[model samples]
Target chain A: MQNLNKPNFKFTPLQIVQISVTVFVILLGLNLWTFYAEPLSKVLSPYWNDNLIDILVLIPAVGAAVAGTLLTRQFEKGETPYHIWQAFTIGLWFWVAGEIGGMVNDALYWDTIYPDFSLVDMFWLLGYFFLGLSLYYQLRLVYGAKSRSRRRIYLGLVAIALLVSAGLTHLAIKAGLGEGYAWIILFVTVLYPVFDLTEGATAIWISFLFGRGQWSRPWWGLILFALADSVNTFYWLGGYGFIPVAAQTVLNFISVIAYPASYMVAGLALLSNYFILRYGENSGLLKVAIKSEINKP
Target chain B: MKYFFRQIEDIPLDHSPVSAEVYFRGENATGLIEKQFNADRVAALLFISGTPGMAYLIEASQSKSISLAEFSSFADGVSHTRAINLPDVAGRLMLLALESKVNDKFTITTEEAWDKKISRWKQEQRSGLVEVKSKNLHGFIFFWQGELQKLDLIFSTPQGFVSGFPKLNALDDSAWDVTTYVHSASAQAYQCTVLRQGAMYWCHKILVRYQEMVGQKLLKMMDRELNRQMQPWHWNINLNENDMLDTHFFPYLMDEAHAYRALFMAMGAQMNFVIGNNLTQRLLSETFEQIRPDERAALQSQRLIPAAFSE
Candidate 1:
C-alpha cells in the first residue's frame, strides 16, 4: 500500500477513465463466467475433475484480485493511472477468493472418509483468505487517514464486524448441529452482508480521508454495493431460481431493500456533515478564520 | 401593459415569463442569482422572487385588467419588455466602468433587436452625457470615453456587455455561443483536466459575487431558512454578522434532496427545458459541469434527468 500524503500524486481524468474500463472488463468477465461456467467446465474437466478445475481457476482469479488491489495502491502512490499486472492480479484474486471459499465448504461437508483433507486444497483456501485479508489491510494502510481517533474507530468497527459475523455463523451452525456441521453455509450467509456494509463504510471513509481529489474508493464502494444488491434484485425477480418463493422474497427484502436504503442513509450522513461545515460557523469564529487568513503572508 | 402587470400576479411561470418579482433571501440564493445575472440587483430581485409572505403581484393583478408591462415603460423596470431588457440600469453602470476607455462610435449589434434598441438608447452621444430616460429608471448614466473595442461584464451586470451580445443573439433562444456571448459560462472546461490529475478545483465565482452584493445578509438568511426548514439540525452560525466565515452548510443527503427539490419546484413553475434525464441531473450538470460518471450512468439507466433545467 502506498502512503497517501505524497504531494505530487493527483488523480487525472484519464486515470478515472482507465479505471472505469478495468471495472467494465471485470464485470464482463464475471458475466461470462456466470453464463458459461458449465460449458467451460466440461471442456476443461477432460484433464481435471470439476472440483479441481474450480480450485485451478482460483489461481488466476486470486492473483488478479491481489494485483488489482496493488494497482489501487500504486495509483494512490502517484505511480501511474494503472498497472496492468496489478489490475489482472486483483481481478484474479477476486474470483479465487470466492471459489476457494466454496471449495473449503465442499471439503468440510461433502467429503467421505474426511477426504483425507488434501493439503494442497487446504493450503489454497488459506492462501486466498490471507490474500484477501492482506488486500483489505493494505487498502486501509494506503487510503485511510492517519489519525489516532480514526484508527481506533476503524479498529473498533472491524472488531465488531468480525464478532457479529462469527456469532451469526455460530448460531446458524448450531441450529443444524446434529444434522452435520454445515458451518460453511452458515458462514457465507452471515459473512456476505456484514462484510458488504463494512466494506462500503470503510471505502467511503478512506476516500474522504486519503483520496482527496480521487474517486477510486467511493466509486468502487458504490458500484460494488449497487452490483451486489442488483444481483439479489435480479435473482429475486427471476423467481429466486430454485429457492422457494417465500424464502427468496425474504432474502430480496434484506439485500434489495435494506441494502440500498442503508447506502442512502450513509450518503445523507455525509451531506449533513457538509451542510454543517458550510453553514455552522459562529460570527466570532468566522471573523477569526478570516482575519487569520488575511493576516497570513 | 395592464395585461403584463396582471400576469405579474402569476410571475415566473414554468414555461413562459411570470410577471412577479423574485426574491432570493437564502445565503446562497443571492450568490446563485449573482452568478446568473452578475448584477447588484440580486437583492432587488429578492423582493420579486416568490416567497410565502410575498403576494404574487401578478396574482393580485390577475383579477383586474392591469398588466405588469404597463409599469415597465412608466414605473420601475419590472415590465416584460424590460424584463427581457439587456444593458439595464445596473448593467449599464458596470458598462460605464468598462466604457470609460471607449471613445469612438462602432456598430454594436444584438441578437435581439430589443437589446439593440436599449443599447442605442443608452449610448452616450457625448462622454458622460448619455441621457437614458424612462419613468422606470432611477440612476445617472456615466459613459467612459474610448473606442468600443469589447463588451466587459466584470464591472457590469451579466446583462451588461458580458451577456449583452449573447442575449441579443439568443433572442431566437437557439444556440448560445460562448465566444460571441458570455465567456464566463464555460468556466468548467478545465475542470475535467484538473480531475484527471487527481486534484479538485472548486470555483465559487458566484459565491464571490454574492459576497459583494449584500454583505453577509444572504448567508444569515440561509442559516435562518435552514433552521426553519430543517429542524433538529441546529446549524451553529451567528446570522447577525457580515462575515463569510460565519457561512456554513449542513450538507446532508436529505438537504441535497431538499435543495434540489426547491430548485426544481421553482424551475418547474417556469418552463420545462430538456436538460436530458431528470431535473436533478440537469441541475447538477449545468451547475457542476462534471457529473459523477457513476451517477450519470445510474440516472441514464433510470431515465431520471428532468427536462426543466435545460431552459
Candidate 2:
C-alpha cells in the first residue's frame, strides 16, 4: 500500500497553464460583467459596489500570497531555494497593500479634492517599493557574486531609466493637473506611474536574462503585465483629460482592457512562476521523459 | 570443468537437477556465481558445513559407498582436519562424493590442494560464462550462524562499492573488515564491508575519494539527464551554511532510498525494490526498526520502495 501521509501533489506545465488561464478568464469575465454588461450590472447594482470590486481584486492578490506561503513551506520540506518564494511573497504583499488601500477608499467613500494623493496613495507607493525590492533580490540570485560590476551597471541603468521616466511623468502631471494642484499631490501622482514603470522595466529585464526555451511562459506573462501597467499609466493620466485629445481617445479604449488585464496578467505570472519552482522539468516531480522536446539538446 | 560451490541440505536422491540450490548467505556471496549456475548448466556442489570427518567421506565415496569406519580411517590418516581450516572447501569434496554416489560414466578429477582449487575458481571467473545480476540498491542481506545479521548498506557502482556513511580513520584494524562481494554489473565486482564497534556492527564507510568522485559524477549526469543549463554545483557553491549542511549533503550519501532515487534518475534508470528471499525481507524490516524515527519517516516519505518489496 502506498503511504497516505506522503502525497505527491505535482502538476504539468500544460496543466498549470490551463488552470491559471481558466482562473484568469473567470475573474476577468466577472469584472467585465460588473462594469459593462447592463443586465448583470442591474442585477448586481446593489451588491456589486466598488467594495465588491476591491474584494474581487483581493482574491488573486491574496491567492498569490497564499501560494507563496505554501511554496516557502515546500522549500523547507524539500530543500529548494527560498528566494523564489520570497520574491513572490514580497510582490504579493505589495499587491495586497494596494488592494487594501483601494478597498478602504471604496468602503469609507472618501471625498477629497485630490483623492489621487490621499493616505491610500501612500500604501500604493509602499507596495511598489516592496515589489521593486523583490525584483532586485531576484536579480541578485540570477547574477551571483562573479558579476559584481555587471550587476552594478544594471542597477545604475535601472536608476537612470526610473529617473528619466519620473521626470517625464512629473512634467506631464504638472501640465495635466494645472498650477492649482498642490505640490504634494503632483509629486505623489508622478511617483505612482514611475513605480509601475520601474516594476515593468525590472520584470522585463529579469525575463530577458533567464527566460528562454521552456522557461518562456513566465516571460510572456511578465511582458503582458508590463504592457498592461504601461497602458494603465496613460489611463490614470487620461482620467482628468490631462493627456492630449488624440492620446486620450486611445487611452480611453486601452483603459477598458488594461486595468483588469494588469491584475490578471500579474496573477498568471505569479502562478506560472510557482509551478516552475514546484514542478519544472528539472524538479524531478514528473517521470523522466528523455524524448520530450524539453529534454532535447 | 569449473564449479561454483555452496552448501545446501536435502539434495534429492532420485532426480539429477543441473542447477545449484544455494541458500542466500550475505551481501558478500558471489552474485556472478549464482547467476552462472542458474542461467547455464555450470557445475555446482552443495554440502553441509560442520559435519565431522565429512571430507574423508567425500573422498572415499568416489569409488563406492564406504562404511563409516573406513571414512574415519581416511580422516585419521590425514595429519590435519583440512575441512575445519576452511569449511567452504568441503563443498568441493561434497561434489566429488556426489559424482561417485551417482556412479556417473564420466570420471571427474578433483583438485586435492585447497590453494589450487581456489586458484582454479578464480580462473573460472574470467571465462565470460559468469554473468552478474544487477540488484536493487536496497536489496542487500547478510546472514550468519543461521540468524539474520545487521549490515551496513553500500551502493554498488562500476567503479567500486560506495559507502553510505563516513568512516573515521582513527579506528583500529579489528574494527574494519571486507565481508563479501555483493552484486555486480557488466563484469565489475562491488564489495561490501562490515565495520564493528566492539561487538556491534556500527556504520558502513567507503573510500572518501570514491564518495566525492561519485557525487561529482552524479551531479554532472543529473544535469545532462534533465537537460538543465544551470548545474547544482553552481547553485550549491552559493548556498548558505545551513542549506549546505542539511539539505544538499544528505543526497551525497546515496545510501538512503531518496538519495538512490536521485542518483538512478541521473543514470536514466528507475528504482524499484524487490523483496528478495523471505529471510532478507524479515531482516530488512528489523533493520528499518533500528533506524531513527525521523530518518525512517524521511525514507517512508520518499515512497521509493514498492509494497511488494516489503512483503
Candidate 3:
C-alpha cells in the first residue's frame, strides 16, 4: 500500500527561525508605525480606528488570500490534497467577507457595533462556518478512508462543545442584560465564542493526532492561534460583565494583545504549511519512516 | 483424425508433461479454446492455425487428478456445440484398444510430442496473423503481491479516449473460482479464470494482448489526472519464458475489441464500482446494470460452482 500520510518535506531549523522572526518583525513594525507615527495617526483619525483594522484584520486577510491562492494553484496542478486546497479557499472567502463587513461598520460608525448584531455579525457567522469546514477537511485527510471511529469521536467532541457553549449562553442571559441588547449580546458574547471554542478545540485535537515529533512547529502555531482566540473570547465576556472583574486591567491588556495575535499566528500557520508541502523533501525535514512491520518481505 | 488417452496412477513426478492437446483444420478453427475441469480448475490455450489460417493445435493441462472419459466427453460436447466437423473417429475409438499397450515409454513419447506441438502452437499464436481492430477499447489488470490491485479501462471513441478505474474494494476478497468473461460485438469471446488464496486474488493465466494506441491513451490520461508521467504499458513483473512457468502473463489476444466492456460489467456487478469522476460513473451505470442476472450471479457466488463455463 502507498504511504499517503508522509509529507513531501519539512522546514529546516534555520528556515523555521527565519519564518518566525520575519512574522514577529513585521507585526512589531506595523504596531510601532501605527502607535508612534504622529502624522499617520492624525490623518487616519477620521476613519474609525484605522490602526486596529490594519493590525487585526487587513494584514492577516492578505496573508490568507496569498496562502489560499497558492494552495488552489497547487490543487489545480495535482500537487496538494483536495480537502486542503478547498479549506484554504474557504478561509480566503471568509476573510474577504469579514474585511467587507469591517469596512461597512467603519463607514456607518454605529455606536452599538461592537456588542450588537449587525451585517458584520452575519459575515462573522459565515467566517465561522468556513473555519469549521476547513478544520473538518483537514481532519478528514489525516484520518483517511477508514475514518468511522475517528469521525464518531470528532462528532462527540463537537456535541460536547455545543452543550458547553449553550450552557454558558444561558448563564449570561440570566445575569440580566437589557432586553434591547439581549440578542446582540447573545450573538457577540455567546455565538462567536462558541464557534471559536469549537474550531479551536478541533484544531488542537487534529494537531495532537499529528504527533509532537513530526509537525510540532505547525502544532505550536495552531495552539498559539487557538489560545489567542480563547483569550479574546474571555475578554469579550468580561467586558459584558458576564465574569467577575477581579484582574480587569491585566485581562484588558491580554485581550488587546490576543485579538491581533490570533490573526497573525493563523497567517503564519498557513504560510508554514505551504512551505512544508513545497520544500520539506529537499530540506530533509519531511522524511517518511517506512512502516517495516506493515510491509514485511 | 486420431485420438489417444493414457492414464498413469504412479506417474514420474519429476516434471509434469503437457496435460492435453488438440489439432484442428478449417475456417472457424483459427481461435482460442478455454475449458474448466471443475469449479476450481480451469485451462485455456490459444490455437491460431498455420499457413493460410488452417490446421490449428491446442493443449490443456491440470495438476490434479482428472477423468479421461469425462475430458473426452467435454471435448465431444464442445465440438458439437461449436459445429466442428471431425473427419475420422478412429483415434478416439482406439482409447480402449490401446489401454493395455500404454507403457512408460509410450507415455514419455506422447508427453514429448505434445510438448513439441504446444511450443509450435504458442509460436503460431504469437505470429502476426491475428487481425488488429482499430479504435477498439482495451483493459489492463494490475496485480500486487499476488492480489488484484487495480483494473484500468480505456475506450476509444470519436470524442477521445475515455478512461476510468473502479475503486479498490471492487475486487476485495474476490473468490478464487471467479471467471471473468470477455466478449464484444466484434470480437472472439475469451475468459480469465481468477484464483484466490488467503487474502490475495490473482489470475493464473491471461491471454489478452496490449494495444500501443490504448497504452498511449492511458498514459496521457494518467499524466493529466496525476500530473505525472506514467508508462501504462510497463509491467512490473517479468513476463519472460522463465517467469511464465510460475507467474501469470497478460495475454495479448488477437482481434478483440471492447473486451473491457464485458469485464467491467462482470466486476461492477460483483463489487462496488467507484469511478474517479462522477460523469463517467453516471454514464457507465446504465451499461453495468444491463449485465444478465445469471452472469452477475456466476461471478458473485462465494461457493464454487459444480461446473465452470469457459469460451
Candidate 4:
C-alpha cells in the first residue's frame, strides 16, 4: 500500500519479464515432466504431481486479476479505452475462476481428467463474452479512422486465419477424432478455438494500428493466450495421436504442457502492462516526472 | 477540468492609496492611459478621499447590461456584474477626458457649478466623488460620509508628470468638464470596476503544476504534436519548453476564461496521447490542485475554472 503515484514503486520491466519467463518454464517443465517422467524412473515419480499444475495456474491467473484491478482503478473509468480494458480484465478473471474450478475438480476426483462438460468449461467459455466485448469496442474506436487498404488487410488476415483453423480441424477429422464424437461435444470443443482465433486476429490488427503507441503492448498478451488455447483445443479433441505412429511417442509424451504456460504468459503480460504504466523502468510516469524536474531551469 | 469564466468577477483592486510612482509608472501622460487600460480594456481609477479608496471606472458602453453568456465572445470586453455600477455621470466624464476629445479648448464651463454643487451635495448629505477633467489636469473631489473631504490631482503636463493636491490659487478654471458619481453607500458598489487581466497568472500556474505533477518534459518533447494541435487556433504566442504560455494572452481580455480553457484542453489532449486518459486525467487534477484554494474558489465562482479542475 505504498502510494501508487510515487516514482518506481513496483517491479521493473526486466523483473516482470524474468518472472513471466521463469513461471512459463516451470509450468512447461512440470507439465512435460508429468508425461515424460514415468517412462524414465521411479525417482521422478515421487516428485511429479498432475494436480499441482492445475493449482499452479492460479499463481499467474490471480496475478492477472490483480493487474486488471489496478488498470481499472488507475485509468479514467469513464473513458472508452478503459472500458475496453475493463472488459478484458473481466475476461481474465473469468479465466482465473475457471482455473480455480479446475483445481477443485482435480482435488475432488483424482482419476477423471474432466467430465464431458462441467462448471469449469462454463467459466472459461463465459470469459469469451468479455473478450469479445473488448475486441468489439477496440474495433469501433479505430474503425472510422482505418483506411480502405487497412480494412481489406484485416479481412484478408482474418480469412487466412479461417483457412488455417479449417486445415487443423480437417487434420483432426481425418484422424477420426470427430467421427464418432457426439455433435454437442464436438461443437462445444470447437467453440474454444473459434473464440481464440477471433481474439488473436483482432488483437493483431489493434497492435498493427497502434504501432509504437500506448495500446500497442496490451493486446499482445491476448495473442499469446489465444495461441495457447488453440493448442489446448486440439488436445481436448484427442487429436494428438492423429499425426502419425512415428511421432506417437512424443505426442503421447506431451501432457498439457502449453496450456498453463500460456495462461502464465497472459497473466505476465497484464502484470507487465500495469507495472509499466505506473512504475516500470524507462516508461514509468514518476521517472519521467523526475527527469523533467531535473531538466527545469 | 470543467471550469469556465463567462464573466470576469473580480477586478484586481489596488485598495491602498496608489503612489504617484506606482500609478503613473513615470510614463508620459499621452501614453499612460493606453499602456495601462487599453491592452485588457480595463480602466482603474483611485481616489484618496474615502477610507475604502478605489474609484473603479469602466469605460462607457452602449449596452449598460450585457449577458455574461456573451462573455465567451467578449465582444465589447467589459461585461460582468461588477460593471453593473455603470459609469453614469462620473464614469462618462472620466471616459471622455481619457478619450482625449478635449486637449485644451472647451466651453463646457462647470467651474462655478462645480463649487456650487459640492456645497449643495454637502447640504443634501449625499456621499460621492466629482470628476473634473481638462487638457492638463485629471482632478478628483472626494466626498466621504456626506462631507467634502480631499482634492487629489494628477497633472499631465508636457513639462512632465506632477501629482498631489494643488493649492487653491494654483487651479485655473476658465472651462472644465465636470461630472459626479453618487455613491449609493450600499452593497452594489463594484459596478464600474473592470476585470480584464490576471489570466496569465492562471496559465502560468497550470504549466508549473503540470511540470511538477506529470512532467513538462513530455510536453517539451512534443513540438510537432503541439504545432499540429494548435494549428486551428492560429495563435502566435510565446509558449516555452514546458508548454507554458508567457504573457501573450492579452488579446483575450474580454474572454480570458475561454481563451485559457482552449490552451488547457489542448495540452490535456496531448497528455492523453502520451500516457493515456487515466494517468493523464489524474495528473491534470494534481496540477490543478497547485492553485491556492481561495483563488480556485474565486475562479470557480465565476465558472472560470472547475471546482477541482479535473479532466
TM-score of each: 0.28, 0.45, 0.43, 0.44
**Stretches of candidate 1 exceeding 4 Å from the true structure:** A1-147, A177-193, A204-297, B1-311
Give residue B124's error in model 4 in angstroms.
50
Choose 1 or 3, whichever is better by DockQ.
3
Q: Tens digit of lDDT per residue, candidate 4, span B102-126?
A: 2222234554555676577678865
Best by lDDT: 4
Looking at candidate 1, what is the lDDT of residue B252? 24
- Superior candidate under TM-score, 1 versus 3: 3
Cα lDDT tens digits, model 3, A1-297, are 111233434656337636765876577556544544544547656354564545445665666557656535433333224455466556656656777777767667645445366676777777677667666665654454356887777778667766776677677667874355565566455766676667767767755544432222333433554566676666555553664566655564555455555556555555554544344333233322111011111
> Using TM-score as the measure, which candidate wins?
2
Task: Indicate the TM-score of model 1.
Answer: 0.28
Write the candidate numbers in order of decreasing lDDT: 4, 2, 3, 1
- Lowest lDDT block of 10, candidate 3 chain A: A288-297
Better of 2 and 3 by lDDT: 2
lDDT of 2 at A257: 51
Please give the fraction of native interface contacts (Cα pairs under 8 Å between A and B) kept by each candidate: 0.00, 0.00, 0.00, 0.05
For model 3, the superposed segments whose C-alpha errors exceed 4 Å read: A1-24, A32-49, A52-57, A76-80, A110-115, A141-149, A182-188, A212-222, A239-258, A275-297, B1-311
